[model samples]
Target: MLMRIILTALPFLSLATASKDTCEWPSWQDALTTCHGPPSTYTVKASNGKGLGLFSAHDLDVGEIVMRETPPLKISPPEIVKGSGYPMPAVTKLVRKEFDTLSSAVQDEIMSLTYHITSSKEATMDKLGIIFRTNAYNSGKDIGLFPKIARINHSCRPNASYYWSDKLNKRIVYATRKIKKGEEVYVSYIPLLLTQEGRQKLLDRYGFKCSCDACAQERAAQDVSDERRTTIQKAFADFEPQLTLEPPRTKKARQQARKNAKASLQLTELVHQEGLADYFAKAYRVAAISHARVKDWKVAAIWANKGYELKYIEDPDSPYTMEMHNLTSNFIANWESELQVGQ
Candidate 1:
């Protein structure tokens, strides 16, 4: 378990107090104590203009669950649009009513969230709307406000991935790679497959420029990265034709399928080398299926195990996980026995 640190002792207090509604802000200790959820493996530290970000307190292995918390404040767009949905004022009133219902401590914490204000002189309802838009996570149909997890910053090439787990009834954050002590944990706010330019555009709505390695590369380097990603996209599209339920009957067709699979793996590797690790499991899955298509169960088993291990970290109960497990087991059982017979 990692220990929690107070925010007041850190640098976020100046901004927390800068608002005209400073009185509404949580007290020094309240601000410090508010974002501290149950301990697991991270501690909060000042991230300059990015505010406070979660940092690993120890060396964490790939696929390890780093943090888990059920959000304290959750609001839905439907709730705001319940009556006279067209009128912003009516929706604003609904939001205010909901905010007023929370305990003073919770309300203070909610108000303390980093948000862009349209009008500083705007109504509290309007401010509430801005807060909800800025901080809310779209949990399928409903948007949830998670003060604690909101502090986690964004990275296009994030080291951590987050997903909502129904079994745990919490939003779980897991390390996607080995994260060293003092490394800041991050999650992608948007899909990772987008080009750097497209990603920056999406993140613009959040009022911060992304400084991720993928985004900060020199123009020549960025062009190379983009070209690699484009090749990966084309290779995956071409490989789709080879994934038939029935394996190719002709030797020529089987050779073509293997060629396509190898091409896809080659392209995927180039993409991964560009610091986009999100494609790693997808590439391994393609390799597993490609090898399995040719009855090369030994190679298939190795790829399947790699893919399954990665998928299991994010979703242990996923159907994909079960499929991978069954495929790996079948390959090992069949191939190991055949090897023994040959020996």
Candidate 2:
């Protein structure tokens, strides 16, 4: 299957990149160029010892789509996850079964990705199995393989981020901030809210130790980043439950909601200071919901605007984007009504 969309997008809010970016997919037009060279703001080139990476061929804005590619390969995730959440879902057989179903052109695209073959005493899978394990991106219902997206490489602090677009049936890479030409676009392959040590533990799955700018900070600075991220993680754990579309039914619940919202707003400022631009649109959306929960429509509108500005750039024409836009343009009427959830 093949699909191609132009290299363009909505306006940005200085939200995505940090003088960096940048990273994926397949179509007839895309089958191989993504692995070799693709015509867009980015291209695939050797990324030193890290293998081939997607590089920005020209300067890109905070809002630009570095690349939007329909996947050449898609596979279902195992009905059951193994060990907390990980590998070995009959990889040897799964890849062989699915691999035979692909078009030769798609097969070539699949082959272009780098892989790390593993062997158990009883079985050793083919290269495609290793490739599938290493590169699959989670899209709703099924995971997919976007060879170019796989090549962008990892960083503790990535300048760009990738989102699975169910609406477009493609993976979109959008700048998290302004990125320079020739800069290697990075995305966080591990949890960004973990400390360096914690992130490294997870990066083990990828078979490399990250030495991104965030990881290379001096001892004192690194400790500071670790603390910030740890706090962010804890705050998120405490705050996520408070995010709701329903109105509070009792005075105690209303007071608790306000307290949680305020705490979340404080966390937002901390994330921005830590240069986690990827967290902003979502944090802002949480802020909006909090304010609206208290009937503070004016402030809620302000927060929704911030979210809409960045989310619009990351995902345009999606239903969520439309909902975000409505929250920004008609906060009182739209969100106020939504607050009636469960009532």
- Total clashes in model 2, counting residue pairs 3 or more apart in sequence or in different chains: 7
Error of 1 at 191 (Å): 1.5
Cα lDDT tens digits, model 1, 1-343, are 0001212222222343243233232321121112334346788889856888989877877766678777666545544345644345654565677788889998888888888654545445466767776777766455567777888999877888877765555677778878988999988888766677877888887888888777788999888767776777777677676654367789998887778667656755776686565667777777877877777767777777777767665666668767776766676666666666787
Q: What is candidate 2's CA lDDT for residue 78?
A: 63
Q: What's each prediction's TM-score?
A: 0.77, 0.75
lDDT of model 2 at position 306 = 75
Residue 273 displacement in candidate 1 (angstroms): 0.9
The Cα RMSD of model 1 versus the native structure comes to 13.0
RMSD vs true structure, all candidates: 13.0, 9.2
Cα lDDT of candidate 1 equals 0.68
Best model per TM-score: 1
lDDT at residue 274 of model 1 (Cα atoms): 62
